[model samples]
Structures are given as structure tokens and as C-alpha cells.
Target: MPSKSSARHAALTVAVVCSAASTLVLTAPAHADSVRIHDIQGTTRTSPYAGQQVSGVPGIVTGVRTYGSSKGFWFQDPNPDKNPATSEGVFVFTSSAPKVAVGDSVTVTGTVSEYVPGGTSSGNQSVTEITKPTVTTVSTGNEVPAPTVIDSRSVPSRYTPAGDSAANGSVNALTLRPARYALDYYESLEGMNVQVKNVRVTTATDPYAELWATVKPSENRSERGGSLYGSYDSQNTGRIQIQSLGATADFPVANVGDTLSGATTGPLDYNQFGGYTLVASELGTLKSGGLKRETTKKQARDELAVATYNVENLDPSDTTFAAHASAIVNNLRSPDVVSLEEIQDNNGAKDDGTVAADVTVNKLIDAIVAAGGPRYQWRSIDPVNDQDGGEPGGNIRQVFLFNPERVSFTDRAGGDATTAVGVTTVRGKARLTASPGRIDPANAAWANSRKPLAGEFVFHGRTVFVIANHLNSKGGDQGLTAQYQPPTRSSETQRHAQATLVNTFVKSILTAQKNADVIALGDMNDFEFSGTAKVLEDGGALWSAIKSLPKNERYTYDYQGNQQVLDQILISPEIRRDRAFSYDSVHINSEFHDQISDHDPQVLRFRP
Candidate 1:
């Protein structure tokens, strides 16, 4: 027993209310008051951060710091009621952790008091005994919305009182803003369909994720593609739960055979692929407010060029894109617009179970330049941070290719950012789980999964914008066959989410730039008649090019005993005005799957 003063110091208590999720999570105690500590006399757990939440569950440390000959360092638990962070938490590593090896999903949680002199950082303000989060282990409840739908105009809205950092940052390090939570960035809204107005958010720090958006009336009444996907985002950075922006499509609603007008930002006409030959033009902000549609010309004589390829894990081991220099360039053969799938970001090693693929996007640039396709500059990708997808995801793969020579990126993040916030509809709810994902004291989820990358692309002289993507493979099984079918089981919602992400981007873009030539292309991971492709066509998202190709020449991938279509190039009526564009799946990689990648490449050609 201690005196009054000492009693007050040891008064912290912790409790964990069990939930449907397998594990009961722990919240840190109030600041200043550290967890109590005491070295266990005899136990095999000789580590320093042991016996605390850092051990995999939330608990009070026995003491601040304990040292033993072989046991090394030791930390006492402050709260006995709290368990460790998780079973395989990413924290509590045995050696000095390097900054580069911080493992994207690897985050330590605890009090960020003054450093312990010999600690990692100077005035670090993070928890000492951090246990990195895991994707599988850190589960949530009812994340899937109970299917539902609504008109684009009936959605609701909430004002998030602005803060000092609310304003967009400078052009150099544009502070990419995350989707507003008050707007419902990640709450379940399956039954409530909504339409989100497209908003443009430019920042220097966040170039790939400059735009953030929300889908109002997020629910739907039926499974129709348009209705199947109310509104969704790929970045999963945050959710914007709000009522539909009372907006509707009025202009001769852009559809097949329709042309789109061009967008003029300043002195430049913006893009060439747009104009009368273009399809549904996206023009507005997906961030907030209602997006009003504007009907425009339906016919243009300009031809547009588009291409989609299954770069087959384009990420090379050494992070060099030059590996395929011969195929990408010298190959004009090199497309005017290219959409690549399987681009990766570096986080950590890929051996064992850590998904943090060492390959990153910079390699893509190098490869393109090495292949001599440097004429096409840089563009945008989906996920803002590659560490851990905003949602409960371990792998962090994204897409963002650009052509500085044509369209210019206004709001953009410089390199990589760990902040949870993003611009407009460009980045919605984060893919990471609601909670930090560490399951134990050692198992930190590494970032290493691939997701589609969609962004505004300007067609030089044509004024058209393209939305690129890479959908979830029907799970990428080697046993896939022409007659094979797997209903959203192994990777059901995974692919669906990819489609939904694509739909949201298209709708938002059209809302903002009505009649702008819009192109949606990529390796959809599904065939022509697959549910994934149907959803895209049904939503009037794109006029798929393969629909015109003969059945024998339609496939871009064939392996095991099956031939399926994985790459596609679709265009909005705005970008497909008349016969201005022609597209076909290329067999360069597919023919030599073993030598190159496993998927095929699709190319589109149009006269700007």
C-alpha cells in the first residue's frame, strides 16, 4: 500500500469491452499517467517491451525500463486489465529498426513522451511499446453495406468545422486533404445510395492523391451496375457519409456515339481527346456540394488513343522499369495513353508473409524513360500512402502514371505522405481497417497489395481526361478456365470494390467536366461477359473496345487450360465520338506469358 500521493500515481485502470471481432482491442490510457511497471522474477519472455500492450495486448508495463544480462530490455505493464495490442503486433522488434525498414503497416503506439535518451528519435511523440497492426487480425464489424440505393439528389450533408490546416497548402508541397469524415468517408451506407459532386484538390505534398470524393445515396435498391455501385473511392483514405448532392444528368446524357467538348483551364485548351468525339465528360469536385451536369456537343472528328496492359507484376526486383525498355518504348507500340496494373510500392521484404513489396512506382518512371517513352509524363494514382492502405489492408499497391507534356497536375503531394486525409473523391475511405492492425507483438502487416490507380488525364490538343484502373483478379487462380466461375467468393467484394472505385471516379469526373472526353481503361481482371465488365458497361462508364473484336482475338491472357480477357480499353462517348478511335487487345505479353508477364496488353489509337 502507498501513501495518498503514491496512490494517486497508481490509480490508472483499463477495461476492454468484447465485440463481434475475434480480438478485443485496447485503447491507451490518458497521457502523463504512464502504465505501472515491475520486472517478472523468472520468465522466458526476456524482451524489454514485454508484459505491456506492446506485447500484443494492452496492459500496463511493469516499469519504465528493465535490463538483464540475456533478457536485454524489459518494460512493465501499467494496466493489468488491458491485453497486448495483438497476437502478432509489428512492434517489439529485437533489433534497431531502420527508418527505410519502418514497414509501411509497421506503426508503434503508446505515449509519445520525451525520448528515453538512447531511444530512436529526438523528441518523438509516439508510443514506445508499439505493436504494428495486421490486416487479417485487425477485423471490423458490418463494414460491408447492406445493399441499397437512392437518387443522386436526396443524399444528406454535414459541415466539418474547418481548422487552421483546412486550407489547401502551397503548390510545392500541396497539402493533400483527406475526405471529410463528417461527410461519411467510411461508415457503412449500403442501403443508402448517394451521388458525390466531384471536387478538385491540388497539393504539392500529395500529387497522386490530389482529389478526394464521396458517393452520396451510397445505397441501392437493386444490383444494377449504376445501382450496384452507389458511390465508392479507391484510396480508402477516408469516408464521406453525406446525402446525395441534389444533382442530375441533364445534357443530352453522354452515351455511346456521343462526342464531348474540351475543357480549357488557362492558356492551354486542356486536352485533345475530349471535344465532340468524346463521351460523358466529368467536370466538378467530388469533395463537397452538388455536381450539376451540362449537355454539350455530341460529335467530334478527333481520334483518341488509349491502351491497357497487364504489366504482369510490372514491379521488377531491383525497382527498375528499364527491364521492359524494349517492349514499352520502341514499341509505338508505345501508346498515347497507357494504363498499367500491378504497380507496387516499397515498404519491406516480400518473403514469408510480409506483403511490403520492395518494388515501387519510381521504377515505372525509370522503365518508361529507359524504354524511350519519356514523351508521356507523370499522372495520378489512387492510394495516397503505401504504408498500409487506408482500410484494413496489408498490401499497398496503387496506380498513378502521368504525361507532364500534355496535362498538368495542379494539386499534388510531393513524394509519399502518411497522413490519413486526402483531397476529393479521388481518395475515399482508407483501405486499412478502422483500428490499427497489429495482432501480436511481432506480426506487423506489411504494405504490398495492388489496387487500381485513377486520375484526371488531359489529352494534348483534345482536352480529354482519362481514368485508369487495375481491378482485382478473379483471385488470380492458375486453375481458371473458360467455363470457370467463382461468385464473389475468394475475391468477390475485392473485385467489386475495384469496379466501384472506378465507377465513382468516372461519375465524379463527368459531374465536374460534363462533355469532356473521358476514358476508362485497364486490366479489369475479368472477361468481356464477366460480372465486373458488365457492371462497368451497365453504369455507362465506358464503351468497351473488345465488344467489337472477334471472339478468337479477344483474349489477352491464357494459361493452365483457360483463355480469359484481363486487359480492356473502354472510352466514354465523349472520347469515342463516331469512329475517331480504335482499340484492340495486344498479345505481345500473352503470347509469351512465360518470358514476359502473364496478362495481355490492349492498345487504342485516336487522332487528336
Candidate 2:
């Protein structure tokens, strides 16, 4: 058996009492040696008397967890201790459904145990519980404890404690300073009934029947009605996850900027998905935010339109092709040229020695035409087997799709999947020697990463160089819900290095020709406000087109409660100086629950 101190912090704190077994009203006086629920919960995650047998634990039954494998009930002390650090409630875990009723005052005799939900190997937190319980009814028809009121003021303004120097620095430690950090505040109330009133939805409802809301409105709010998600800032301190404990059908479908009018009363619980969640039995009515999807941009014949979309690992066997093709054609309005990312090998995820993506690309083209769009011709270089980092055996790579009638690809010889592409000056203009070639394929920055694909295209006698990229992803970065204060973005170092290489290549093109029409676009995998993006925008060589939008509206991806920017299209100095470019974040996905991809495609129309 593992020691209780070694377990992570308790995620759930349920306290329950035994009900009357017979019709006879049991009237027994409280025992003098009875242990309080607050003492069992203590100020820390592990119970003070863990692994020891305790008798006469008294409380009123509050809730019953009848469904799950760890069937248990929650009980709370009617008169809680005045200490803010110690919680007044705890969970009693039983092997079977607890035969208890709300308002039943009972004394429990059980062995205190620290129950890890997913076992020791999962790295998940444990729930402090009392197992092998024997219930003895002390009295019947007792009043339930009043719920603690929670609002902006009750929640601390600080999002997290200071580094390890602070008293409450350790996230798993029981030393909670509820008055200082919001995480500590929630931890202090773990498993206790709390009420949140007049909250605004910060994120759209997820498929798991949950939504995030802000207790108090802030200045950085979106027009759609939710708080704008700041990057690890204390401004998002009051944001909390709201989960419906009942049926998924009982949960209301809502978008950001929506309102939950009445007070939502629930127990404060912690889980692996979201750090702290309010498991609500009573939910407030949802009011619409009046948010609507944006209209597709109009295409002009005088200018050429280019788009970048991450199809999310498209393969010949996947059924999402039709939906993605429909989005590209109907939602994005069929740009003259499109830079596609995450195109998988012909066999999809099958690890069979297949490295070709021709079948996969053809299926998407056929889907585009079938969806009432123009016929699109594709060009790409097959990546080395399992060298590019993505799904195993998927061999995901970047490809370009263009309408042959509108824009023609300037394909030259000597370009393969592994070889690097070189830039040359032709007729006093900078161009790629190979129409579709990899840029610095052997660069250490692109180790186990997708190489940038450079393609030269001509639309109406004007030459434009487009570099399609799928930079390093945020795979190994610490999660926002991690146990660390201001979690580190470990993947950014690689992305920054990748950005440097792309910036160097763009500088070479500009050095050769002062006013080259260059457009770099794709899923860069870093935010527009991130340092990785700054590396790509150094010295005015390229300008992030997404920044052209208003500060509140600049987002192409939505994660948690934040509408953030991950995919971007950066243009050269000539394109930005002319002021002849217009761009739109075609909002066909990312906001809705049934999205074709996690990202929304971006389109840029400019007169080169």
C-alpha cells in the first residue's frame, strides 16, 4: 500500500451520513470523541488520520455518487470551523451504492484512506476518502449546511502563487492561501457546496457538457460577450469550469458571450481535465450572446487570393475529406491558391511502407469539385518515411492546391522530398529554382519536423512566391491546468528556431529582389503574440497579416476559454507597404462543437 503523503492532492471531497435503517426515529446524542469533517479534510490534500480507523465521524449527508464505480456519498459538517485553510467537507467511498439520504445526521466508523482515481501510474491526484465504512444513524431529518457564496470578490485576484519562494507555492501542498491565489481558493473549498451567481460564459460549451465562465466581467472582453482569454495573466483569475453532473441533454448549448442568469449551486471538485470544476446539480438558464458565424469573403478578379488551412491529418481512408472540402470551397470561398498542411500518406495511419500522398490529395481534389467548387490541381514532395513528426506512419507533409485556370504553378526540375530548394534571380526577380521544393530540409531546426515547402506561382502575369509551413507544435509544453505556477512553454524553443530558419530564407529572397511578392502561410503552431512569431517578423522582412485586424478579433483558434491565433499569413514589405491587401479569418470552424478541424482557415486577397 502506498503512503497517503505520497498521493497527489484530493480531487473530490464528498461527505455523507447514514440514514435511518428502520421507521423508528433514532435519537442519539453526539459522542464527545466524534471527529469533525474539517479535521479529516484538514488544511492539506491528505487526511491527517489516513490509514487509521476513526469512529464517530459526524455530519449530515449532502450528496450521493450512486453511478460510478467508486460509489460514495458526500457529507458536510453542519457547523464548520472558522479556519479558511481547512475545508468542512469530505467524501466517504464505499464499494456499493451508499444507502443514504440527504439531511440524515449519522456517525461513520471507517478507515481513512487516500484513493487515487486512476491508480498510481496515472500521475493524477487522489481523493481523500474513508473506506470500509459502517454507518450508524445518530438522528434523522437534519438540516443541510448552507452553501458558501462565491463571486469575483470571494475569488482571489491573483491567478497563482509566486514561485517556490511563496508559502503557497507548491500546487499539491495543503498550505492554501485562499485570500491570495485563485487556485488556493478553490482548493480550500474542495468538495464543499458553493454558489456562483450572474456569471458570463467565457468559452463555448464543449462536447463533454462543460463550459468555462468568468465570475466577474473584465475590460478585455469580446463583443460576443465572454472575457478575452489573456496569456497566463491574473486577469483570468475568476474563470472557472462549470460541469453538468446530469445528462448531457440537460446541459444547454451556448457560445462565448452568453450569460448564465441565475445562481449555479454545486460542489467544488478537482479533476484531470480541468484543474477545478464546479460539478453543478442545479444550472442557470442560458441566454444567447447573439454571436453569429462570419460570412464568406468575396473573391475579386483583379486580385489573387491565397489561403492556408490545416486539414488535420487528411488521408485517403478518412471520412472528413468531404466536410473539409466543403469548408474550403463553401466557407473559404475557394481561394485561387491554397497551402494545405497535414496531408497524410496514401494509406492513412497504416504503417505499411507506403509514402505516397497522391491518392490522398486526389480524393480531396475530387471532393472539392464534387462540392460545387473549381477543379484544383495539387503539387507536393513526399516526405521521408516517419522522419517528419506527426502521427506514426502517417507521413504527414505540406502540399499546395491551385486552380489551373486562374494561377499556374512554375514547376522546375531537380526538386525531391529530401533535397533543399535554392533561390535564383530570373529577369531581375527572385524565384525558387524548383516550383515546389523544400527549404533547408537538412537544417537542424527542422529535425523531426515538417520542412517548409516553397512554391512559385503566376496569376495574371504577376509572379508571387508562397512558402507553405507547418512548424513545430506545442506537444511537450506544460498544460494550463498543470500544477506549476505560470507553466512553461517548452515547445516554443524549437518553434523559435524553426521561425529563424524561415525568416532567414525570406531575408535571402528580399536581399536578391527588393520588392518580391512573397507570402508565407500555414499552421506556424505559435500565437501571433508569441516570441516565435516575433522571430518571423524581425526587421520588417515580413508582417503578420492577422495583426491587421482589431486586437479583440485577432484569433484563428480557440482553446479552453480563449480565442487565440495559431495559424497566420505573413507578407513581405512590398505587400504591406502598398496597403493593397485584405484578409479574413474565415470562421467556418473552431467555435462550434462539430468542427471539421480544430483551426479556422485564413484567406488573404492582395494585388501583387
Candidate 3:
């Protein structure tokens, strides 16, 4: 009964949920005449009895969701069937406030539905539901079903089944194998009351009032109390999202490594963000990890600081310029040079073939100066119309903002939007033939993507080569919540190719000058541990500065419940061997809900 907009919004939510799956146990009543919740849920993501009327569906109302488009109450069978594949509980979508109380044993009649919360085009899984119920309160004050305990042993360590060809890889197929796969496990317990004990927070609490946690220790556990979000092959099945069904205020603000001990009891619910979430009515106490917002690093006159930040599609029309500028100046300590990604066209997303970003760059520069930061001189090669893949017509590309007082750009002739930059030996030194030139623009790896912009600058009388990159994103790749366990990371293939191209260029620079100071940094759109990073670091030509930090402090981005590294700075051997480098993943944006960009900028201070 949700309105069109709310249904669309909910559909989007479910679409996000389809990215991953969780584990749970379900039970059915013994009565043959009365339809069980499992019968409606079936084995696939879609319900078997969808669009059909059913009578005498008996359950105890465990929780009620009165807010949002999904205003309904959840009920589950007290006498659960022995089948592990079947879910004992189901959501009764009333479309409005339902006259149901917790602990009330009710026999209801309604139509079964497979509702896609985000709408049809969202590519999300359908949540089986019962709608338009005519309820009969069999009794009040009935005991609720005991919550299922989910831990490392109870939930499957593996994330997904090997094959999803059956039932299109949906939980609705009724082929629940909770012991084998995590998705199957969560699907089996969908809507059932569940409990997670002694879990550590894997993702920080978001404004959406949800947090992801790893139940017990995981195989890819990080030193700082959270599990590493490994490659797509490893789904991190131990992790599950936690949602407070009662009050948003009750949900604790927690960071990665924080602990939620005692009994966090709630009903298993499926939504768009995290596939399976524990909608807990009773949340345990949160043990803080002393994870505080980091302060700006001290900058020295001899140290040349370089930083990479994804502005998240900054345009002239957007109003986040001030916040972003403040972060750059205050949080990043006003780095001498900053490689900025996602600088949109002048008119932003209007897409009217206007590819110039002078207006956008000027606005940001003006803001940075106003925010107690040094005035920056910007350089960029505008993309050929809408060739760059991003917001339609936005023409997002990478740009360099260097403080004129701290560093000077080594501008050479012949650099244009389409021409590829080459490493040339000038006066027996490795230097870019065309400063601020694209790296292999004609290469297939850069097709429809923002090509790397190579700029030469002089810092402390040394020629330093900087490559600003905004590589192909993980757009077509499956989300972690994908129905297919071990979701496909189709985006990595392109990123690997892109990394190879950059590495080749770095090798060319090293060939010209063995001790060339080369720094490649930006949003690579791949994790540090990914094969793409491995390819970039091949032959020791360049090293990811993030890896130099402690294992726990390597992330600059947070997705789902996993603190990850998407933004990075890679330094050449000459710079690395100098051993006079300091790096910090500026924790200004990614962990906070009120963030200016989804990515937290990373800074590297070194004396060349």
C-alpha cells in the first residue's frame, strides 16, 4: 500500500539488498490445512503463493514497523517446522499502521506477494510479503518464538553458492542450504527472530541508522577489530547489517573495531542496502574503540605534500564547495599539490556538450582561498565532450590544484585533451613531454573513462612527475549484497588494464631516469589488496603509499560495513628509497554521515 514514490524508494532499497545475502533459520507450523509462512516464502526470492489468497496463517506478532512506506508488522510461527530452508516468520505489509501488538498470537488472512522494494528496474531481489490482512487475534500475551543464535559456527563461512543458475540465484527457489552458503543461511531465517552475540563492528554507523558487524572473528579479520573487505571472491559472509526497528536514537554511534556485546536480539529483515539485517528491538551496549576523528598533520616547509581527493562530481551548481574546501585546507593540512577527481563540466550534469570546467575549478579555488587556504593554480585537460563515463553529460575528469607559492608547474607545449603524454629524457632527466597531458588517451583502457593526467612540477628544485587519475569505476560490478555469493567484480578487469598502462608509463619514466620522483595518485576504484593494485605495483616500479601505513590504517573509503581503500597514492622507487615520506588517510569524510564526498582524501608528504 506504499505510494508510488515510496514504493520506488523502497524498490531502490531492495535493489541494494540484492547485492548480498545473510543466514537465518525458519520454522513452519504443523497444521496441514493452514498455510505456513514458508509456503508463501517458498525457496526462491519470489514467493510461491504470490498474488494468491491464503487463510489461517497463524503467527505471533514479534515486531511492528509503523514508519516509512513499509508500515507493517512481522509475525512468525511459534511451532516451527524442522525444515531449515523454510522461513518461520513473514512480514505483513499493511501499507499503513496495523492494529497488531507484540506477543499477540494471530491467525490472519491475506494475499502473498513478492515485493521488489526499489521497483522493477532496480535489479534488487523481491521480498516475500503478506498484504491486506484480515487478522484474528487468537490470543494475547503469548510467548514469542525463541531467537536463533547466529555466530561463526552457525552461519556458513562461504558467502555464496557455486551456481545460481537455478531459480536465477534467488532465495525464493526454496532450495535453502544454510550450512553451505551464507545467503542460503540468511534466507532460511528471513523474518525470524535472531540474536548475534559478541559481534565487532565492521562498518561505522551511518545516517541511515544502520551498521554492519562481523559475528565473531572472520578469516580476513583486520588488526583494528574489523574484517577486511577482501576481493569479490571472498564475500565476508561473517558480516551482517544491524538496524534498530524501534528508535533511531537507540542505535549507538560506533566505528570500525567497536564491539556490541551482550545479546543484540531482533527479527531478520531484508532490505536494499544490506541484504539481510537484524532489525533488533533490544540492542546490547556498545563498547567504544576510541576511534576518534583524526586531526590535521603538521606540514613542514621542506616537505612537499601531495594529496588525492574525489570531489564526488563537483559542479558549478553544487553548494558543497565550501565544505570540500574546508576539508582540503583544515583536514588535509593544505597540501602543496592535490589531485582532484570527479571535477564536472561547467554546467555540472546539464550535459549540453559544455565540457569546460573553468567555472567549476574557479569556484573551488575561490572557496579554498576563502577557507584559510593558499590560493591554488589549477590545470586540467577537458574531456572530449561526454566521452568520460560518469554522471550523464557531467564529463567528470581529474584535475590538479597546486599551490603556486609552494610548487611550480613545469608546463611544456603540445598537451591537449586527446593527445597521450609520453615520458621523455630532457637534459638527462625524466620529464613529461607535455605537462598536464593525458596518459595513453587513445588506448582502449581509457575508452569512455577519464584518462590519467600527467603533470610535471618542481618542488625544492627537483623535477617531480605527477599522474592524476580517475580510472574506470565499479559500475557494472555486483554489489556485496548481490544474490550471487562471491559476486562478480567485472570492474576489476578494466582497472587491471588501466593499472598496467600506468605501470608501463612509470617504467618508461624509470627507464629515462632510474631515480625519477614519480607520484601517481587518485581514485583508482580498486582496493589496495586487489589484483589491480598488484599489477600497478608489479616489478617494484611503483609502490602504493597506503601499504606503508599500519594494516589497520590503510582505508580511505567505507562501503557497506567494510572499511576499504579506493583512493591511493603510489610513489616511485626513488621517492620510496628516500625514506623521508609520511602518509595519512585523512579521516575527514568517509566515516562521517555528513560527508562532502564518499571518499576520504589521502596525503603523502615527502622531500624530493
lDDT per residue (tens digit) for residues 213-307 in model 1: 22322322111101111121211121221211112232222111111122201000001111000011223322222222111121123433456
Query: Which predicted model would earn the best lDDT?
Result: 3
Per-model tally of clashing residue pairs: 174, 10, 33
Q: Mind giving the per-residue lDDT tens digits that candidate 3 earns over 1-608?
A: 01223444544554433122311112232223478887776665666676677898999998988877678888999888777878899988786788889999998887676665444333445677777788999899988889999998988877766545664544344466788988888888888999999888878787667888888575576655666665656667788999998889878988777889799998898776667889998898999876655656867989999999999888898889999888888888889999999999899778689999999999999999999999999999988997878877888989999999999998888788888888778788987889879888988888788899999999889989999988888765655655544456777888889999999999999999998999999998888888888898999988999998887678888777777889999999999997599899888776654567778899999998
lDDT against the true structure, each candidate:
0.34, 0.77, 0.81
TM-score of each: 0.40, 0.85, 0.84
TM-score of 3: 0.84
- After superposition, which runs of candidate 1 have C-alpha atoms over 4 Å from their true positions? 1-304, 316-320, 347-364, 367-371, 380-396, 406-451, 476-490
**Predicted candidate 2 versus true structure: per-residue lDDT over 1-608, tens digit per residue:** 01111121232222122112201111222222468878877775556676667788888887676764557777778888899988877777776988887778878888776554333333334456667798887777887788788897898877766445362233555477889877778777877877898888877787668888888777366655555553556346777888875676889787777888898877777565555678787799988877776656767887898999988878887889899888888888889999998999999778887889999999999999999998999889988888887877889899999999899999888788778888888788887878689988888888888999998899888889899999988765655645555666778888899999899889989988999888999999888878988899998889899888877777777766667788999999999998488988877676765566778899999987
Error of 1 at 448 (Å): 9.0
* TM-score comparison, 1 vs 2, better candidate: 2
Order of all candidates by lDDT, from best down to worst? 3, 2, 1
